[model samples]
Target: MSTPKKPTEAKAKPGEGVSRRGFIRDVGLGTGAVGVALSPTAALCAPPALAGPGPVPVTLTVNGKQHKLELEPRVTLLDALRNYLDYTGAKRVCDRGTCGACTVLLDGKAVYACNILAIEAQGKNIQTVEGLALSPEPDPLIRAFVNNDGLQCGFCTPGFVMAAKAFLAENPNPTLDQIKRAFGGNLCRCGSYNGIRRAILEAAKSAQGGGKNA
Candidate 1:
């Protein structure tokens, strides 16, 4: 009969094998855990490093609520709203002052979203189209759009709505000529300006009667 090896010797190899595996696992997972823990904080505290000189922290009051965000110093209000805060109602088009597609409300005034840098809007009450639908949404303006068929592609509708709200707030009862002059800057390729104008008038009338007039 062949002689059997010692159990103590066998036990030593098994112990070594388990220790080796534990060492490998710890080494492999150590950096990954650290990376995960730090990434979310970096996102919350720092903006993406663009090819710019520096970044700025901005506080925006949107829809009667305050939000704190870190953004690149050069980022526009449109991009910051859509990309960072996930408010994408303001459409980005032309990106210059030519097209009014990215219109938003700043302190109850209409302003081009793409032109104003996000950091410049600090301490301002910035209202986006997203808020338009929040308080009993499909308000007078949205109802008018539906009734008048004011949207063709619907891309420029948000800008028009923002402009109209500002206009009506200024002149609750506006004539056709006044309405045309008020919304002159907004452009629509679908030729829906006529419908949009009528819709605004309807909404203004509705707003005059406490948002209940059909």
Candidate 2:
């Protein structure tokens, strides 16, 4: 068979050439393709950025105790608790306040530790899952959670429990709607919201008869 003819190089004119047109088109397509491929991946490969300035001295009251820590101002309350204070009860899953795994109670209200800065928690009574049983040996909510198997894999359990405790603290006798609203901020990836609901109801009932935060 005869050999295939190669592409003839196009000579350039003063203002135009076939090679220049092809080269321009190829360059544009190549750049466009590279941009399309790199955008999402480049975002992913970007570094874990700090919120702002370097670590600052901050005092946070945890579980009726005070802790003086020098941490990055950008650090979230969840990181402050889990990484700095060794309070691992608050899970760090979905640290953007979506998964409710990093929930805690601030001034008896459920707040996602991930959403708030550690510095913002100052002058507030911050309570975690660990603080639920502070005085009582076994908190009623904790007991209810354990009995109802409200947790699976136990990732969102802390946030659920903390939110429940805060809910019960506010509305010791909550309607189902109230309970649902109370836990609206917390989400469980394991689809254990039903169990969490049941556990909350049980805890509320228990708290009603002079039990715990019902």
> Scored by CA lDDT, what does every candidate get?
0.74, 0.73
lDDT of 2 by residue, 135-191 (tens): 757898988888888988887888888878877787878776667677778777778
TM-score of each: 0.72, 0.70
**lDDT over C-alpha atoms for residue 129 of model 2:** 84
TM-score of 1: 0.72
lDDT of 1: 0.74
Indicate the worst ten consecutive residues by lDDT in candidate 1: 1-10
Worst 10 residues of 2 by lDDT: 7-16
Q: Report the number of clashing residue pairs per model.
A: 0, 2
